[model samples]
Structures are given as C-alpha cells and as structure tokens.
Target: MALKATVLKARLNISDMDRGYYQEHAFSLAQHPSETPNRIMVRLLAFMLNASETLTFSKGLSDEGEPELAERDLTGDITLWVAFGQPDEKWLRKASAQAKAVRLYTYGGRTVPLWLAQNKAALARLPELEIWEFSEEDLDALTGWFERSMTFQCSITEGVLYLNNDDESLTITPIRIKDRS
Candidate 1:
C-alpha cells in the first residue's frame, strides 16, 4: 500500500530572512562575488513594488485529494484571505477581514469602521490606487525615464539603485508568490 502526506510551513519572517529568496536572486545577477549593501536594498525595493496587489483566493475540497489554490469571485469587491502558506477556512476569514482593515488607511482615509468593512467579498474589489504629487520637473523626468526604459526593451543597469534619504528606507516589501503549477 502507498500513502501520501501534506507539507506546511510558516511565512518567511521579513526582518530575519533578509537573505532568503530575493537577496539570493539579486546576488546571482551580480557579475562579481562581493555582495553590496546597495544591491540588497535595490532588489528588495523592486520586488516589493512589483508584487503588491489584490489576490482572489480559494481552497480545494478535502475529497478532491491534495489542497489547491483557486480564484475567488472577482466580479464584486470583497475581503480576501491571503496566507503565507496553505490556510484553513477559519484563518482565511480572519485574514480577509484584517487585510481589508489595513488597506482602508492606504487609501488616505480615516480608519474603516468594523461594520462597514466586514464584508470580505465586497472589499476584495477595491482598486489599489497610489497617488503621488509630482512636480513639473518630476513629471518630465518620469516621462523621459519611461520612454527610454520601460516602453522599449532594455536591460537594467547594474548598481543603479541608491538611497536618497533615511526616511524613505522604512517601507514594506510586498509578498511574492512563486508559481508551483
């Protein structure tokens, strides 16, 4: 007879696991062996900016064999459960509520009332809007940068990321989900 087992793990601790995935990837991209502090910061920032988003999540049925990830409803805005690893339904419901609560402040508003933000499905459809007040010089620079870099296909320059101030350093690096399927 044959048997199967399931595997579970906690989410990587962001503060402690600095060298785990993102840093390793960035180091591999380097031509030399010495790991620069700036490279670590650059890759981390890039990873965060790219990965933040609203994800619809669903779980597989127990009788279906191994659990699986599936899409939830995207038609309506709702709160969603996002886990660092495979999650149980109770945890999902709790996490969905928490995530929605946190995002309310991100929209530049007062704290969302518990009653108003309780619907998980309704909160999921909220668009992630990032507003930046750009000056005329900043606007022109952004356009020029996008035209020369993002619009056309070009390899990114090495060691180009740098820190401008101490205040800009405290930022949350968004979670990146690796494709297993």
Candidate 2:
C-alpha cells in the first residue's frame, strides 16, 4: 500500500514588471506525501517566477528523470529545467545537458553554505545553470500563507517578489549564487 499525492488547486495572478509580462494562470499541482509545506510553496514560487504558457509542473519527487518543473516549446523541446532543494551534482549535470537553461533554488538554512562550498566549483562550469537560494526565514513566512485552495496576487519588481493573499503579504528576494550570464 502506498500513500497518494495530494492535489492542490491554485489560481495565480502574475505581474512581472521587470519582464513586462502580465498573466493569470490557474492550475492544480500534486504534493507528494513526504514533501513539506516549504517545498510546496517553493514549487509554486518557481512557477510564478517563470510563468509561461508552456511552463508546467512535472512529476517531481516521483519521476527521477524529469525536472521539478519545465518549460517546453511547441515542438516539445525543453527550454528550461527548474529544480528545488539541493540535488546531486550529477543530476544537475544531466539537466544542464538536456535543457537550454537550468535553474536551481536551494534552501535549508545553514546547510546551504556547506553544500555550496562543496559543489560551487563544479556547478560554476555549467554555462546554463543559475542558482538561487531562499533563506529559511523567508521560506517559513511564505509557507505560512499556503492553503489547499489558494488564489494569490503576485508581483515581481526589481528582482523581488511580492505575494499577497488579501489578508497577508510576503516579500521575498531570492539571493542569486550563480547567474546564467
């Protein structure tokens, strides 16, 4: 017997002033049994950060070969591969080889420094890889706003994200460890 994934419904209103992109997307995402609320929110944030018609949540945690999220072209060519948490270097290497761009969102507080010290040199060599880190406190605040049926108004400006659920708002600025440029 196995535990089933929980399906979460979300409607996101996005205004990316930096990119001059504005769109609203409504979708359902699955949360694995072992995944925490922080991870779920991270996934949603990743989708909001790279909102596109072709960007979609993949079989994350369940499918090892697939990215946590991906954006593909009409021809089914992968344009971007997005990963959350700290993945093995080999996994990132494979993702870098397969996708046009690879982005990793690393979280988990103090462990991040040690992890970066061990892997930064190897990761820096990957031209397509961009790494961002979410602070534990900020992530905790973001997770505090999570709900099963959620409708969020999200705005991004000057590389900062403002997410509001009407009752509360969270400001998040992910720190970039490595830029694709």
Candidate 3:
C-alpha cells in the first residue's frame, strides 16, 4: 500500500509591519511522506509571509503544475504564485507567464549562492519574478517549533521575520537575490 499524506492543522496570527498587512489564517496542510519537517516549515513560513484572504495552499508536492501556494482573485485569476526551493528556468518562465507575480524561496546553506550565480542571467530576464534565499540554519531553527496541531504568532519588521510559539522562537532575515520591477 502507498503511504498517505498526513494532514496537519495550523492557526497563524501574522503581523507584517513592512507591508502593513495583518491577518489570521487557518491552514490544513497535507504533508507528503518524503517531505522533511524543515521543508514543511518553509511552506508554512511562505504562507505567513504572504497571508491574504485569497491566498491558499495548493495540491503542493502532489501537483507538478501548481505552485505550493497561490493567491487568486474572485474570478479565479491567479494573482501570485509562491514556490519553494530551487526551480529550473523552464518552470520559472512558465510561472511568470501565468501569474501576475511569481516568488521563489530558495533554501540550502552554501549551495544556494552557487545556484543563484549560475542561473542569474536567465533569472534576470523574468522581471515579474522575485527570489529570496534563506540559510539552512534559520530553516532548521524554524523547524524546531513545528507540531501537528500548532498556533504561531508571527511578526515581520524591517524585512526580518520572527515566529514563535510558547516554547520556541525563530528569527530570520531572508536575502533578496532578485527584485525586478
């Protein structure tokens, strides 16, 4: 028998001073068997960073065509597509064409910089795409606060993120690799 995805529930209170956006979101995420806790936390972090009434998690790892998270308008037009980790130039090209905005969160300690350097020219062509890179240590620390049923109080100020529960807390400042306007 194939392994089933684990459903986890989370309630997040987000305060993003940088964007002046504040909202509460309830999420039900299906954790794939092969997905690590760190990656799962990254998904949650991505959601918190872009919390919106229309934002939602997609089929995630199970769907190749869909982004990990997306925000859509009432007419079902995709406004934003959020992807995790490194994606190839082809995928980035497709996403930029389909959505109004596309954002990628790249993680991995030393490998992330090298990957960016190698793909810089190709990535720069997509003016509507944005890329942010997080360190492995920050992700590891964020994963420590993960739980099946959890509540998080998240704050973002001056481009720095702070997430915490009752027992643990994490602070991360993501590096912006590409910002095309």
What's the TM-score of each model vs. the native? 0.19, 0.96, 0.94
Superposed on all Cα atoms, the candidates' RMSDs to the truth, in angstroms, are 17.4, 1.0, 1.3
Best-to-worst order by TM-score is 2, 3, 1
Off by over 4 Å in 2: none
- Over 1-181, each residue of candidate 3 has an lDDT whose tens digit, in order, gives 9999999999999999989999888878999999888888888888888888889898658787788799999899889999888889889999999899999988978888888888888998998899988788888888778789889999999988898888877898888888967
- Runs in model 3 deviating more than 4 A are none
How many pairs of residues in model 2 come into backbone collision? 0
The best candidate in terms of TM-score? 2
Local distance difference test scores for all models:
0.25, 0.90, 0.87
Residue range 112-170, candidate 2, lDDT tens digits: 99999999788888999999999999999988888889999999999899999979988
Backbone clashes (count) for model 1: 12
TM-score of 3: 0.94
Better of 2 and 3 by TM-score: 2
